[model samples]
Target: MFSPDALIASAKRTISLEQDAISSLLARIDDSFVRACELILNCKGRVVVVGMGKSGHIAHKIAATLASTGTPAFFVHPAEASHGDMGMITADDVVLALSNSGTTNEIVTLLPLIKRLGLTLISMTGNPDSTLANAAQVNLDTQVSKEACPLNLAPTSSTTVTLVLGDALAIALLEARGFTPEDFAFSHPGGALGRRLLLKVEHVMHSGDELPAVTRDASLRATLLEMTQKGLGMTLILAPDRTLAGIFTDGDLRRALDKGIDVREANIAELMTHGGKTARPEMLAAEALKIMEDHKISSLPVVNENNQAIGALNMHDLLRAGVM
Candidate 1:
C-alpha cells in the first residue's frame, strides 16, 4: 500500500497546482471573455456548451452555472453531437466548444456543421492556434503551466482553469443581466433560498374561522376562551365590521392579573394592545419573521387596510412552511 504521507503530499501537490491554475485564470478574463459574455447575453436562444472527454465534465458544469445565473445554457457531448446530436444546434444558438488539446477529433468533426448553422462559436482550448480555437469568434485560453498528475497525464490543473474561466463568464453575465436573488429564487423554488424569498405570510397564515379572535367589548373570560380554543397563545380583538381593534396575549392577561383586574369584570379593550404589530398578507415570510423578531413577539396578526384580522400567523407557522 502507498504510505499515508506520500498520499497526503500528492494530494497537496494537486491542490497547489489547481490553486495556481485558478489564479492564472484571471488573465483569461480579457476581451475574449467579454465577447463571450456579450454573445450569451445578447443570444435570443440557449447557450450550447460542447466538449469531449474530461473537458465534457467541465463543460456540463459551465452550462449549469450559466443556466442558474440567467444565461440559459445546456451541455452537449461532442461525441454525441457527431452521433446525430448535432441536430440540436441551430443558427439562433451560441456554441461554447471545449477541447484541452484544441484538437479533439469528436469536436473537430462537428466544426463544419457548426459553421454551416451560422452559430456563434466560443472555444476554450490550451492552444489558441489549434483548429477549434481558430474557428471561434471568441477563444478562451484555459492552458495550464503543467498537469498536477504525477505522470502529467490526468487533467487536474487544466480542468480547474477551465472551470474557473467558466465561472468568470457566468458571473460577468449574471451581473450584466441584473440577475437578483429574487430571480435566482424563481429558478430554484424547491430550495431553501426560494422558500425564503417566495413564501408570503398569506400563504401560511390561518385566516377566517381558523383565526383566534375576540372583540373590544368582550370580557377577559371570553378572550381566554378564544386563545385556548385557537391554541395560538393569543387572540385578536376586532371591531363590529370585523376589523382588527387590538390584540390580547398571554402577556396581557398576566399584566391584567397583576393589576388585580377580575377576568370576569375586565373587557378585551382594558387588557389588549391597540393597533399592535401587524403584517400585510403579501409580505414575504422572511420579512414577517424579521417583524416578529423586532417586536420580540411570537405571533403576528396579518391585517388588511381596514385593520381587519385577515390572518393569524405564528413563528411555528414559518418553521412549518420552511420560511424560518
Candidate 2:
C-alpha cells in the first residue's frame, strides 16, 4: 500500500497543477468569451448543451448551473441529438458544445444540423484551430498545459478548466440578468437555502391566542403558566395599551429562582427582561434566526409597527420550518 505521506504529496501536486490550469484561464477570458455571453443573452430560447465522454458530464453540470441562475438551459446527449433529440433545438436557441480535443465524433456529427437550424453555436475546446472551434460562432478556449494524472491520459486538468469556464459563463449571465436571492429561492424551493430566503417570520410564528402573553402587572407565576401552556419557553409582557413591555423566559425564571425571588408574589414587570429583541412579520426567518443566535436567546416576539406583540416564535419553530 502507498504510504500516507506519499499519497498526500501526490494529491497536493495534482491540486497545484489544476490550480495552475485554472489560473491560466484568467488571460483567456477575451472577446470570444464576451461574444459567447452575448449570444446566450440575446437568445430567445433555452441554451442546449451537448458533449461526449467526460465532457458530457461537465456539460450537464453547466446546463444545470445556467438554468438555476436565470438562464434557461438543458443538456442533450449528442448521440441522442443525432437520433431525434435534435428536435428539441429551435432556431431561437443557442447551442453550447464541449469537447476537450475539439474532435468528439458524436458532437462533431451534429454541427452541420445545428448550423442548418440557424442556431448560434458556441464551442468550448482545448484546440483553438480544431473543426468544432472553426464551426462555432464563438469558441471558448479551455486549453490546459497538461493533465494532472501521472500517466497524462485521464481527463483531469482539462475537465477542471472547462468546469471553471462554464461557472464563469453562468455567473456572468446571472449578474447580467440581475438575478436576486428570491429568484434563486424559486429554483431551489426544497433546499435549506430556499427556506432561508423564502420563509418569513410570519410563516413560522404563532399568532392571536397562540401567543404566550400577559399584562406587565401579571404575577410571575401567571407568566410561567402562560409559558407552560404555549410550550414556547417564554412569555411576552404587554403594557395596558397592548404595546410590548418586556419578555420573561425559562432562563429568566431560573435566574429569579437563584436570586430567591418568589414567583407567586413578584410582579412580572420586575422579573422580565426590558425591551428585548423583537421580530417583524415581514422580516426573513433567516434574519430572525441571526438575531436569536446573536443574543443567545431561544425565542422572539413578533411585533407590529406599533411595537405591539402580534405573534411569537421559538427555536423549535425555526427548526421545524427548516430555517435553522
Candidate 3:
C-alpha cells in the first residue's frame, strides 16, 4: 500500500510542475501569437479545429470557449476528417490544428488537402520545427519541459499548458472584438448569468389583476385579506387616484399587534410603511434583487414614474424564476 506522505508529496510535485509550465507560456506570447489572432479575427468563416487523441479533447474545449466568447469555432476529429469530414472545410474557413509532437499522422495526412483548398492554417504544437507547425501561417508553441506524471510520459503538463494557451487566445480575441456581458448572455441564455442579465422586472413580477392593493382608508383586516389573496405576503396601499400611498406587510401587522391596535379597526395608512422601496417594469431582476437585499425586504412594488403601482413581486417569485 502507498503511504499517505508519499501520495501527498507526489500530488504536490505534479502541481508544481504544471504551475511552472503555465508560467513559461507568459514569455512565449510574441509576434506569432498576434499574427494568429489577426488571421482568426479576419476570417470570414468559422474556425475549424482538428486534433487527434488527447489533443483532440483539448481542441474541443478550445473550440467551445472560442465560440462562446465571440469567435465562431467548432472541432473536427482528424481521423473523421480523413474519412469524409474534410468536406466540412471551406476555402473561407480557418483551420486550427493541435499536436504535441506536431506529427499526428491523422492530421498530417490532411495537409495536402488543406493546402489545395488554400485555407489559412494555425497550429498549437509543442515542436516549432515539426511538420504541422512548419505548414501553418502562424503557430502557438505550447512546449512543456516535462510531464507532471512521474513517468514523464503522460500528457500532463503539456495538456495544461495547451489549455491555458487556448484560454489566453480566446480572451485576447474577446477583448479585441469588444465582447460585452450582454453579448456573452446571448450565447448562454439558459445559464444563471444569462438569467440575471436578461431577465427584467416585467418578466417575473405579478402584474395587473395579480397585484395586491387596497385603498389607504381600508382597514388592516382588508389589507390582510388582499395580501392573502395575492399570496405575496404584502399589499400596496393606493390613493383614490391609483398612486401609491404606502405598503403593508406581515412585519407591519406584527408591529401593529405589538402596539395593541385591533386588526379589524386599525387604519392601514397609520400601520403601513410610507412608500417603501420600489422597482420599475423595465428594471433588471438582478437590480431588483439588489434592492431587496440591501433593504432586507422580501417584496417590491413595481411602480411607474407617477408612483402608480403596476405590479408586485416577492422573493418567492424571483426564486421560482431562477433569478434569485
Write one digit per residue (lDDT tens) for candidate 1, span 183-232: 99998999999999999999999988899987788888988998998999
lDDT (10s digit) by residue, model 2, range 48-145: 99989999999999999999999999999999998999989889999999999999999989988987888899999999999999999989999999
| Candidate 2 clashes between residue pairs 3 or more apart in a chain or in different chains | none
Candidate 1 backbone clash number: 1
RMSD of each: 1.7, 2.5, 1.6
* Tens digits of lDDT, candidate 3, 11-79: 999999999999999999999999999999999999999988899999999999999999999999999
- What is each predicted model's overall lDDT from 0 to 1? 0.90, 0.95, 0.94
lDDT of 3 at 150: 84
Better of 1 and 2 by TM-score: 1
Model 2: weakest 10-residue lDDT segment is 111-120
Residue 176 lDDT, candidate 1, scale 0-100: 92
* Model 3 clashing residue pairs (backbone): none
- List residue ranges in candidate 2 displaced over 4 A: 1-13, 258-262, 265-267
Badly placed stretches (over 4 Å) of model 3 are none
